[model samples]
Target: MTSDQPAATRLSELLGWRKSPDPGLTWAQVEDRLATEVPRGVKDLSLCFPTGSFGGWIHFYNPVQSERALDMFLGRAKTKTENFKYARSLNHAEFPHRFHPEEGGLVAWGHGDQHTYFWSSQPGPESVLYCDDHGDGWGQYPGSVPEFLHALFMDELETEVLYGQWAGCRFFTEFPDYAG
Candidate 1:
């Protein structure tokens, strides 16, 4: 594995991805729905592969079907929406970040078995990721989607959330029902 390579490239090489991924997506629809700019690597991933999972875990929703392929990513935004909303309702300081639609709030991007990954427009550009692990609280990943996945796959990322077992599971499995 090339430690310093981009996640998309690394995954492609690892999986012997030879065909070019066709991008049949509309970015505006995604951005409008999420209320934020989609990270660059995410767009790249969608363009690089099919909708699938790495290590039989972690799913990323590529809402628009691509003629090519994309990998599975994660997040359950509505939960955090409720979490932050409830926190706000009770005037509780439980969540450090605000949920999306709250101006620079967090938006769910992917998820693992017990954790959810997120991105916040608050950080401006640099593209930082936030992971809320059900068992370990929250942690941050400073990069785009592929970067995070690549780092996690390489065990180069520091997180108290994503389990070590799942982190290095580099095997990619395409979703059976995926049409793309």
Candidate 2:
């Protein structure tokens, strides 16, 4: 799908999802908690869709007002700084990633099948960063969060690491407590 297309529309078409389930939660609270602004499309996607896994392999974190309380977006993003610091210490100096508020720091958004997705928090536009199996290697997708997710699930993007983590399947399974 193109950037002109709305993420919910493209994703619904591609995934055969028929509902746009919004819980009417404002993003202001979530953003306040993170101390960083989440991309519009990313917030829209989270709010518009129910909590679920794609092909049981990838999951956008639970929405801001998730009732089940697992994997809340702000919780994950807030912990990124600390997690990355430890990761850098355990690994090496050339690890090449920092948490938000620092130049080129990364904000963790989603993870599944040992693969993590992040937004490179910088001065200009944000890009999706992918790390496979929590390994040292990195891949950058120069697009919005929705675009990366849409393309990844649609087989329009070739992520070498993704191929190993998941078979390209579009099946979506909603979480049991996902209010729809």
Candidate 3:
């Protein structure tokens, strides 16, 4: 559960993909490949947004804010007597209607429906910005990623399993048991 153990396990999982013949690739190589191939902005953002298994802590912040949080989290992790490795960033672009490169998906803190969702898409002739899930799905709009980021920093969005529109998207936060 420590950072080193999880890092090694994750690295092994990545390298073990199909069991590559080249033994030269190390964990560092895997990290480099992930950094280069995946979009840095999105990948970094995902790291800031922890999934459900990790108590669903959402720290929304701009680039600067994100770095600050990351540093603090790393520091705290280092101080801990128990070693725990948090989840690594993964590709989450498939749910275009919900997530984006700038502001991460809807993040709200506290119990109940506290999270606010946002999506940029081409609505009719002009592009529009939506507070929650809306629009046909596609295109870009405006709104500082800092807005959502800051809000997330202050609060933790209540994660839930959304059916309907989000059914096909690969990156969804589903509860352990949800009939629907």
Model 2 per-residue lDDT at 134 = 61
lDDT, candidate 3, 62-98, per-residue tens? 2122334333333332322111111112222423333
Flag regions of model 3 displaced more than 4 Å: 1-41, 53-116, 119-129, 132-147, 152-180
Best by TM-score: 2
lDDT of each: 0.63, 0.68, 0.26
Better of 2 and 3 by lDDT: 2
Model 2, 120-176: lDDT tens digits are 767577578887646646788887777777777767777676664222577677766
Model 3 TM = 0.21
Clashes of each: 15, 0, 10
Report each candidate's C-alpha RMSD, comma-separated, in the order given.
4.0, 2.9, 18.7
Candidates 1 and 3 compared: the better one by TM-score is 1
Best by lDDT: 2
Number of the candidate with higher lDDT, 1 or 3: 1
User: 1-180, model 1: which lDDT tens digit per residue?
Assistant: 666866777766765565543445577756665567776777777666666666667766564554222222213566657765676566544466677778887777666566667777675664655544532366777777777776677678776665775445677666655554
**Residue 104 lDDT in model 3?**
32
CA lDDT, candidate 2, residue 113? 73
